[model samples]
Target: MLKKSDYRVVRALGHGSFGSVFQITEIASGKQLVWKRMTIVNDEDRKMALSEAEILQNNKSDYLVEYYGQFEDESEFYILMEYCEKGDLRKYINHLRELKAITSEDMLLDIFAQLTEAIFSLHSANIIHRDLKPENVFMTDNFIIKLGDLGMARVIMGTQQHLSRIGGTIQYFPPELLIQIEESEIAKTDLRPQEPVIQTKQCDMFSLGVIIYELITLKHPFADQNGEVLRTNIIKCKPNPLPNNTPESLKQLIMQLLCKDPTQRPSIQKNKKEKHQKKNKIKNQKKKNKKEKNQKKNKKEKHQKNKKEKHQKKNKKEKNKKNKKEKQQKKNKVKNQQKKNNNEKHQKKNKKEKHQKLNKEEKNQKKNKKEKHQKKNQKEKQQKKKNNKGKHQKKNKKEKQQKNKKEKHQKKKKKEKNQKNKNGKQQKKNKVKNQKKNNNKEKHQKKEEEEEKKEDEKKEEEEKKEKKKDHKDKKEDKDKKEDKDKKDKHHKEKGKDESSEEDKKGQVQHDKNKEKKEHHKEKDGKGEEKKEEKDKDEHHKDKKKEEKKKDKKHEDDKDKGKKDHHKKEEDKKDHHKKDEDKKDHHKKEEGEKKVETEKKEDKKEDKKEDKKEHHKKDEEKKEEEKKKDHSKKEEEKKDEKKKDHKDKKEDKKEEEKKDHSKKDEKKDHKDKKDKDEKKEEGEKKDDKKDHHKKDEKKEKEDKKGKKKEKGDDSDKGEEKSPNVVQAQDIKGDA
Candidate 1:
């Protein structure tokens, strides 16, 4: 009979020899439960079920499944438990198909932690679940694992005695269980006993080790076969080494767990506790080391950055100082040049005044000499008449001479006044000339400075234009290369079609023949282009050279013009010297009145020699300036040649780089072709091998069918099931 109101049986989930588990719903609250039903007609089985229910109901832990209730019907007892939606660890293992999913180390560690907690809870409760396998471990949707089946579990202090019958699933049973029983009696009794032959904790540890090994390798450590084969292997064989993919730490732990003797297996709780302590220590140490490393790295980077900044600041200061010094020097030079120019203008003015004064003085001296001679002659005539004639006639002659003398004196006064006026006007004109010359020199200096600035701007503009042109040319070349690469890739992809591939192969052969011809054509084109560019460059260079020559010629003309101007100045200076000598002679004549004029003339002759010496000094200065300008021009020409040589070297380097790039492109194309060919060959070989294997399998199957047909009844009697054959083959192989 089934209960109608209290509990509702839903559907069977799974069944084993001892019990059947069902997904059930409570009638009162509609709560789901995994109902484990066991037929417990025997008193001992009933006691065991009741005991298990009591143990489950008493113990409450997140790591263990909760027991809801226990109830009995007419024939069977039902134990309701918490339903785990994700089923059990066996399903998880099967889903992943491996012990560890790739890149799921954290998930594995979490599983280990939960499993350990579950086992620890069972141990603390003084109960031992003798069977702990992947199938007995339940997992929730959140991946929480709980040890589930407790059919083989025993309470340490229970009134019931230990059973001689074996209990646990064979695959996970410890070695002691198998060894304790005789080989012949193994089939007659259970393989596991109710009471563990060894320490219950140690036995559980062995089971945990098997679980860990399975978790790591996705396969049981001793799973060599099925049925009796697996049982035999478990009894006789040592576990294989941990898989290559397992972490070294995890593998070592598994190896220790897989030890043959139960005593040799490490305690699970102790290992877990120790690992926890070690992990905490390592985490603390890592944090401390990271802090120290960061501090040291920061200090080093800061020091280097500071040093760099300091260096930059120092360089900037020095550069500023240098620029200021240069500016000051230029200012001083300009001032000195201005001063020199002013001095030259002043000297020219002084020389002009001196020459004008000399001419005026010489004219005055001649006029005075004539007047004195005329007066003397008139006086001589008066004396002669006074001696020969009477007193009245002498008186009349004296009156006439007095009137003529008065007229001559008036005329000489008028001539002196005119000469004074002329000298004053000449002095004013010389002053004006000096002022205008100073203004002209200042304007000329300003014009020269402006011209220099304009030249520098023009040079910068030309350089910018050249840079822009080079950039444009590079852009064009890059675009062309990109286009060529795209074309090549498209052609290669298209050429993979069989028909197109054949055509392409033929074309390639033709292309190889045409390559030499095309290469020659390209070479010719390149050569012609290079030659044209070279000619253009040479033409530009020649134009520059011509410009330089023109500049030099202009400089030479300027020098010649300066020399002519200097010669004119020298001639002017010589004239001034001559005038000064004449004036000196006139002064000496006036001072030495009675002394001979011959002395004055002799002094003038000596002054002429001095004038010639001054002229020679002026010529020497002009020659020195010419030499300096010529040397400066030579230096500029040499610098230009050096620049041209550097530019030529740069051009050669650029051309070499272009050649290297072209070669790289060709190599890359060849590499791509080779890779495609190799891939094609590999695919063909793989297909052929697969086809051959299919043919062999087909022949074998056909032969087997033919043999079966020859003795149908006999074959049926003797033949094994296909499943049995496969199982046997697996057993044999294992």
Candidate 2:
């Protein structure tokens, strides 16, 4: 019933019908706890869980494990209990095997007593521990027993004799239940009467019997090859044979608890609890007796301790006095020894000083005698040096003359040898110089040939450039001619419009002259009747003539603007042509400068060749007299180097040939590129021209559209003009 979230799970201890048992820590208090988790998936499970929790919560005994709390969640319920440091009885029983199995009987009886007591308490509370096994019995670090895992426990009515339901581990099953299981299997086959088997308190005692035997012997009481064989043995009511060394009392207790008949099996009434009480009583008696004996021993130890203390104190006091006296005597002796040592040291130092003074005087006398001896030795050495100096000077003069004669003889011999070999050396030097000069000439000739080839290549390249330029220029010229033709055609069309305009002007003038003549006649007849009407008519005709003159002036202004625009365009084209021609002239100048630079470079190379030839001749003359490291191997290496150079030169020539071919291809590409560029430029120019022409046409169209609108407005204005004529007529009437 514990809240699972309230504890941090340390590790899982085990899992069974109730989900699992975990060693955990309570979060709030840092208390270690055990969680028995059981999922309450349905009301029946919930009810069973509540019953188990109730049985745990209501029960209280040192022999029975304590329940701390419980809680339920949506999916599961948890029962929190005291955490047993030592895990369970089964593990401890297994450990008994290593500790000597025979030593386990006493421990087993104690644990068995506790288990039986816990079961008695459960039975008294109308609860049956259906699954009593060694694993369900927990132990503490102090070897305290705790009965746990009441998950299979059931509550019974007060008058109920036993539980008729099946539960518990097979190995721990009582003989009665084994027989019942066998009977149930037979009943299923309709081979026997169907009798309900019930779990009484004897079942738990039987389990305790098994736990006891297992702890003492380190195995199950009815152990076989497997649970099934054990089950068959259990159904036959065949119990495990006890060893001969097993205590009679302990063996008898286990045998009686595991009796095949529940009626014959001893309940908690007179078995474990009574034995526990008797054991406790004996233990109390033993403790009392031990305490009495301990008290007597303490009194005797105290007297002995006091006597030893007094003797030690007497010895320490006398020893202290003796040590004091000894220390004084020793100190006095040390002082006397120090006085004696000081005296001796003083005597030794005085004698040493006296001896040192005597030695100094003796040393002084020896020094004077040595000085006299040294002075005499110095005079003798000076006399000897004077004698040896004369001998040394005469010997050096003879040796100097001998060396000079030898040097002169060697110089003459060298001069004669030089004279004898001079012609041969000169001939060899000339030959070496000639060879060097020939090598230089060959190198210079090859350089000149290469330079000539480079010049030829340059000429070819320049020719190709010129051809491409010419081709592009031709295409540009053609495009320009086509544009010129288009412009001329437009001009011819404009001329026709001008002639038509002249005819329209002539017709307008003739109409105006006729109107003037009519008006003059009207003026001539103004003296007659209806004079106002005549004046109105003449005024209207003059107004019409003025309107015609205004429209004609607008048309003439538009034509003048068009002509000025065309002239500006022609000037721009001429300026573009001049720019292109200037670019061509600059390019030609650059090409000529490049050619001149090539000639200058060739002349410089020739001068370098002449200097190198002179240098080579001088070097060869010097090299002929010097030892050179040239050998046949060196000659072979040089030949290899020459071949490599030749191969490189051939590769370079091939590459240059390919480059020349590529250059031809590139020139063709450049011609195409130039033609493309020229065409694009021409097209761009044409587009600009066409755009301008379109704009002009658009403007003309806009004008014509405006003229149409104007014509309509003119009709309106003309209609209104009649009103002006009427006004004039009105004036005439006035």
Residues 1-734 of candidate 1 have per-residue lDDT tens digits of 33534777778888877789998776544567788889987998898788778878887766788887777887798887989889988787777774446427777876776777777777777777778888888876556676787877876664223343556766677776667644532331234545545435667777888887777677788765442325555677888787576689888777777677767877645576775774575457556756885887688778778988999999999999999999999978986775474454235444664686578758866876786588668757865664455456447656765775687679768967986898799789989999998787667556645754664475467557645754764575566567777775554344233222332343343334333332332324334344445445644664584355335434534534454456446755864675576557656655665465678778878878876886797678658856865786586568657755865786687568758866975796698558645643454454466567557655765667867665565445434543454355334323
lDDT of 1 at 433: 95
**Over the stretch 166-273, how does candidate 2's per-residue lDDT look in tens digits?**
777766777766665544322111132156567777778788787777776676666565533345566675677788877898889888987777788877775667
lDDT of 2: 0.67
- Among residues 3 or more apart in sequence or in different chains, the pairs in candidate 1 whose N, CA or C atoms overlap within 3 Å are 99-218, 166-192, 166-193, 167-192
Best by lDDT: 2
Off by over 4 Å in 1: 1-4, 98-103, 158-163, 181-199, 225-229, 270-734
* Model 2: lDDT of residue 305: 82
Q: How close is each model in CA RMSD to the real structure?
A: 64.7, 62.8
Clashes of each: 4, 7
